[model samples]
Target chain A: MDSLGLYVLAAAVLFGVGVYGLIVSEHLMRKLFAINIMGNAIFILLVAASGPVEGAPDPVPQALVLTGIVIAVSATAFALALMVRLYQETGQATLSSRDEGDDG
Target chain B: MTAEALALIVFLPLLAACAAVAFPGRWLGWIVRIGLLPLPVLMLAPTLAVLDQNVIHLALAGHASPLGIEWRLDPLSLLMLWLNVGITVLISLHAGVSFRPDSDRGQRFWPLWLILFASMNALVLSADLFNLYVTLELVTLAAIGLIAVESKPAALRAGMRYLLLALMASLLYLLGVGLIYGQTGTLDLYLIAEQIEPGWLPVTAMALMIVGLLIKSAVFPLHAWLPAAHGNAPGPVSAILSAMVVKVSIYMIWRLWFWGAAGWDLATAANLMGLLGAAAIVYGSLAALVQDRLKMIVAYSTVAQLGYLMLLFPLASTLAFQAASYHLLSHGLAKAAMFLAAANILSSVGTDRLQRLAGVDQRRPLDVFALALGGVSILGLPPSGGFVAKWLFLEAAWHQQAWGWLVLVAAGGLLAAAYLFRVLGVICLHPRKRLNRRQHREIPNLASVAALILAVSAIAAGFFSAPVLSLISAGLPPGVTP
Candidate 1:
């Protein structure tokens, strides 16, 4: 496979793992990590869509990747803050509503 | 003038966000009010010249449409903007009094709220896919943060779950954007729409985008996140969350399929969505009727109201579009009024439980009036916005002879009335407060006034349908004209 195909496949794998973790993981921190993985996967896929450039890389996807990374970082940091605060207040790392089984 | 007014409308909210933090905590609440002073000038300016040929494209930073970021202001955007701004202003007015700047939640709430407003305003005006992704993320983060503002365990848990689901939705949406970009080499929605041929990639992208929007909008089967998040948030927070945030994705989905691209005969697809909507209306109303907490009831009703909008998908027509827009306005105002009033009652009485609520009307007459008036609209009573909108929907369905949809519309309205009257019945059965009557006096608060204004406006919407319809018609998006 070409490098572009490899990148796309890697993104797909990362995205699958992230979605799986996001849904199945009980802990909030793991979920946040899953979100990060998913975010990275999207970034990879976006960069891949930009195609390979030997002389000069496409600026559009590069610019988008930079902005996406910033947004992801800020979102991750905020989620982490929330996770820590929830753990402190309730002494539990998982969400209570899930344990309550109200989702059923 | 329209361009300047629109630009300021988007940016002034960002200014409010900064002022929320820059000013001293004591001054923050009132100071943000001062920042809102610029929006009223849009009222003074003449109406925007929306389109020459079904689109009024504006380029930012002196760049033209093909290269620089582009924005479009069609009727849908204009209508959404007007509704969004009206709700934001009312809620902000309520917030200034309800959340004292010195309060813990208030200090964190104002900045995020103003930023959410800016993001939503930008999202509606945006004409491109990549820009929409950024604004959507901003909106989701601000909304999640608002949900967690209370920092209580339930609120935190709700907020975390909301964040997870919203992130998932955004990823799905972004993947669609990626697919479209890979195929079309452009992120501008109109350009992408033009280049989109009925192929595997285009079809897959459309499906992904629609699924993402459905989840985010909490339409039916994907609706579990909404009740918990909206129900758990603080009052004005829930008001905007229920009224505006959920609508944005659905609005975008509408723009994509019906107006922008995906012009192929998705007749079966539209009918399927209509079926899901029917389920949402029935299930959501039943769920709302059984909800113990008042906010939970309102939140579930939001799911049902969203379903009402989805019916427009199957019955796509000028009348149906107009009906959906009117209903959206009607529901936004009425629901905001109800949630704000519920907040007043919950805070004053210390419980949102139906059995515990007694003499709330006596304590807060204006707030009760707000709830009742809002209930009237939700129930689709005459001389209210909901009634007019539903009537139009019924007429549209009948004209198309979509008999199933006609039945769903009638049944849904009846179910809405049933659930709404349940709350009204409870209110009328007001028991004497545990506290002495003299101890519980109605203290004046702007929240009640905000609620009252929204309630009055929802009723007023029924009368001004002609003008609103005309305004909406002015900026209708171009039909598929290859």
Candidate 2:
């Protein structure tokens, strides 16, 4: 099989695993990791989708993946800050809102 | 000149966001106020360049499409751009008076606020799929930053949920973009439009992208994150989030579908979107009727109003498109006004509970008036922009002989009225318990003034739909033949 086919399959698998983690994990940190895995998976797909030229990587999707990486870093930082604050204010980082009252 | 102005519209806010951090504490408000100086430049400049008989495009870093970033201007972008500018200005006006300059919330709010404005303008102009993805990220990040500014448990938790969902949504969108790239070998929107082959690749790409956008736009079932995020954020944050931020993603969905996917024969997809629109309208309105908190009611109402915009996907005519565009601007104004007015009540009463809002009309008469006027447009009554949009939507549905959409739109409006009046009803009744002075801080005149002007203009916009419609139809985006 071609490199593109392998990349696509890998992206699909990583995305599936990440989605499962997001749904099954109660902890926000685990969820964040799942999201990062999903993000990296897409970046890989983006790079592989371009089809390598004479063994040299195309700059556009690489540039895109680089940009995506920066965005992901900042987003991760912000989400972590939010998780920290939620933990501080309410003393838990779990996603189970049904057990708790909103106004509390 | 127009190109420079368009470029300035996107860049000026980014510069200000960077400058806001350096500009020191007490003068931060002044810096923010100065940051908005370019808005008048944006408003006064005629953004369209059709007079030159040239295809309007701007290449960032002096690079062309496919290999470089690109921005394109058309009537739909201009319409949404104008709406974004107007709503942002009014929201800023309210926010300017809402907090002290050195306060923690104010400090946390300005930079992110400026970034969101820039991101939205960039999103409006971007014509390349990868550039669109970047802009979407910026928009989502800045919105989460704003939502979490309160540092309260509720706001923080809501912000986290919003972040995760928004991240997932964008990843799905990016995957679809990747799939299309695998097929087409390009990310330029118009290029993709011209070359899209009708097949499973396009079909799967469309499904994934649509689901992604639907989740980001908070169309029902995915809407649980919205109320807590919107309702708990401080007033101005909620105002901008509800009014302009959500509309950004929806606008992207429309732009992509119409410009790139319209030729792909999306009959089944379009019908499904129409059904989702119906479900969102009915479900959201019912949920709004049952919400006890004032902001919660407005947040749910936003879900229903978004349904009206989604109707265009199914109807897929020039008139339906125009009606959807008009409704977006009108609903945005009305919702922002309503949220700010709710903020006023929350500020005065120390809580937003329905039971605590007794005699709010008597207490903050102007704010109540603002709320009621905003509700009038939300209900799509005559002599308002909402009414014009509803009438146009009905006409579009009639022409298509889609009798079901006609009933859905009307019923949604009726249900909207039911919930809106429920809040106003509380205002007219006597308070079950008297509010002590601590709970009865006077509502600021500036707050009500901002809300009143926006609400009235939403009504006034009704009378002037002719010019706006002509403008949008006049400059229909490239690849979308009228």
Candidate 3:
């Protein structure tokens, strides 16, 4: 396979790993990491999939990647803060152990 | 002039959000007012322009598509703009009461609220797929933040689950955007629609994006997070989340299916989507019937109400388009009213437990009235916006001679009626001893009045259907025959 095809395959593998981690890990922090990994995978695919324009990498995908990175980072930061707050409130960082009748 | 106005519609609330953060306390109220009050007046220019031109496209910063971002305003988008403005401004009245600007909760709530508002306006107007993803993220983040703003353990947990799912969904959507961009080399939705062939890659991309949107919109089987999140949020927050937040993703799905993928033969996939809608209507209503809490019922109703929109894909005609778009408007107003009313009831009566809410109508007549009025629309009764929309849906189905879809429409409305009447029966008909004066806390009239206005307008929407229906028909999607 060519180098571009190899990168696309790698991104796909990474995305699968991220989805696996997101499902298996109970910790909110781990889930956040999994989400970021998935985001990174998409970024790689975004940049890899677009062909070069006149021998230069496509500028639009690069710009899109940069924006995607900013969004992923901010979302991660917010998720981390939420996890901490959740831990403080419930004394548990995982969603599974919450009290069933506590919904109000 | 129209371009500047369009820009202002998005940026005004965003600017208010920044200003809200800088000056967090006493000035927040005035900031929100200044931010939102001019929106309707500003929307007039675009409204007129769309009416005259059928569709108006603005290339941001004077660069054309395939390079610069584009914003399109057609009848559907114009309707969305009006709904966002009307609902947000009215709901703000309730928020202003519940989350006082001088209070700490208000300080956090207003900024996120403004940001969500701006992002939604941008989302509806966006002509680029990547831009839609960004705006969807912004809307999701801001909305989840609002959900957890109260920091109740339940709200926080709900927010966390929603955040995780929303993040995953955005990534899926982004992957699809990447694939589409790779193939078409243009991010513009119209350009992609024009250039895309009915091939494996493009079909896969469309499937990925639609599934991502389905999750975001909380269609059946993907809607587990909705009840807790919408149920636990503060009154105004829940109102907006149910009314517009979820609807925006569905709107994106509509844009993609009818406009972006116009040329593709999606008959099988459309049937699959319709089946999901049928499932959601059945499952959501049945789940809602058993929910003990009032807010959860309303939240589940949102899940069910969203089903009507999916029917459009299968019915795929101008009538179906009109029906679905009209459903969006009516359901948005009704659902917001219901949430706001439920919030008031919960705050006043100290709980929304269906069993505990007996005789609530005696003390909080306005709120109960608002809730029932909103329920009338949800159940698609006459002289309500929902009734008009449901009639259109049935007519669309009848025209297509799709008996199963026609049955589903009828059954959905009946199921809606069943759950709605269940709530009304408990609140209005249950016998209870006279409550002690101390048992009920007095909520402000303004909160109840705000909900009443929304409910009344939902009913009012049925009266003004002709103009809106004609406008919707004026800009039908490419493949549909008007």
Candidate 4:
């Protein structure tokens, strides 16, 4: 296989690992990490999949990756804030520990 | 001239959001009015342009497609813009009372609300896939933030779950965008449609994007997070979430299937989507029937009503498109009314528990009436917008001779009626003698009036169907023979 195929395969593996971690980890912080990892995997694929223009790496995907990173970072920050607030309110960082009967 | 109007339609609210952060207290209320009130007036230019010329395209930053971003406005997007403006303005009246811009909670609410408004306008106008992703994220984050703004443990928990799911969904959508860009080297939706070849890679990309959108739109099995999130949110927040936020993602799926991937033979996938809609209708209504809380029932109803939009894919005709688009409008109005009324009842009676809400109709007659009026549309009874949409849907199904879908559409309406009447019976009929006047808090009359107006408009939509239906037919997707 060529170098591009190798990179795509690597990104796929990373995405799988992120999804696995997101499911298995109970802590909200861990889930945030898992989401960021998944985002990085997609960023890699986005950059790797696009072919070079005139032997120079295409700039459009790079620009898109930069925007994606900004969005992912802001979303992670917001999620972390929510997680901390949740922990403070419920005395637990994991979502599973909360009782299901609370309606509002 | 149209370009300036389009720019203002998106940027005005964004500018207000910035001002909202800086100017707190009394000035904030005036700022919101200034920011939003002119939006409908501004829409007139674009509406006329679209009416005259079927579709209008504006290339942002003066560069054409495959390079700079493009904004396209057709009948469908024009309709969405009007819905967003109309609903947001009316709901703001309720928010004006509940949040009270002079208060701290109101301060936290208005900025995010305006930002969500701007992002949705941007989302509908955008012709690029990546731009849509950005706007989608903006809408999701703003919505979840609004859900958790109250900081109740329940609201916080619900918002957290929704945030996590939404983030994952965005990543899936982004991955698909990446794959499509790799294949076609263009992020423009129309350009991609023209350039894409039918193959595994493009097909895989479409599937991933659709699944991600399905989760975002809360269709069937993917809808576990919806009831809690919408149920726990503040009244105005829940109204917008159910009315427009979820609908926008479904709109994206429509654009992808009917416009972006128009040439691809998605017959099997379309059938699968229709089956999911059927399941959502059955499961959501049954779940709603057993719900003990008023808001949860309304939230579950949102999940069920969302299923009707999915039926368009399998029917795949001009009539189906019209039905689904009309459903979006009517559901937006009706659901917003129901949520606002539910919020008022909860505030007045101190709880929305169905058992505790006995005799609430005596104290909050207008709110109860609003809830019932909205339910009329939801049940697809005659002379409501929902009836018009459902009639179109049945016609489309009969024309195509799809018996299974035809039966499901009919059954879905009956299920809707069953749950809606169950709520009405409990609230209106199950009366306790001599309710204590001291315990009931009186909500402002304006709040209740806002909900009633929305409910009345949902009914009025049925009467004014001629012009809207004509607009929808004029803008049918590229491949459809309208």
Give the per-residue lDDT of model 4 (tens digit) for B336-382. 99999999999888788887887788888999999999999988999
Mind giving the per-residue lDDT tens digits that candidate 2 earns over B197-293? 7798887886788778888899876787888888888888888888988888888888778877757777777888888888889998998999888
Instruction: List TM-scores of chain B, every candidate.
Output: 0.95, 0.96, 0.99, 0.99
Q: Residue B138 of model 4: what lDDT? A: 99
Native interface contact recovery, model 4: 0.62
Query: Cα lDDT of all candidates, in order?
Result: 0.82, 0.83, 0.91, 0.92
Structure candidate 2, residue pairs in collision: B75-B475
Q: What docking grade does candidate 1 earn? A: acceptable
Count: clashes, candidate 3? 0
Candidate 3, residues B214-310, lDDT tens digits: the string is 9999999899999888999899999999999999999999999988998888999999999999999999999999999999999999999999999
lDDT score at residue B347, model 4, on the 0-100 scale: 89
Chain B alone, candidate 4, TM-score of: 0.99
Off by over 4 Å in 1: A53-57, A98-104, B43-46, B51-55, B65-67, B430-443, B480-482
Better of 1 and 2 by TM-score: 2
State the fnat of model 2: 0.57
Between prediction 2 and prediction 4, the one with superior TM-score is 4
Mark the regions of model 3 whose C-alpha exceeds 4 Å error after superposition.
A51-54, A100-103
Off by over 4 Å in 4: A51-54, A100-103
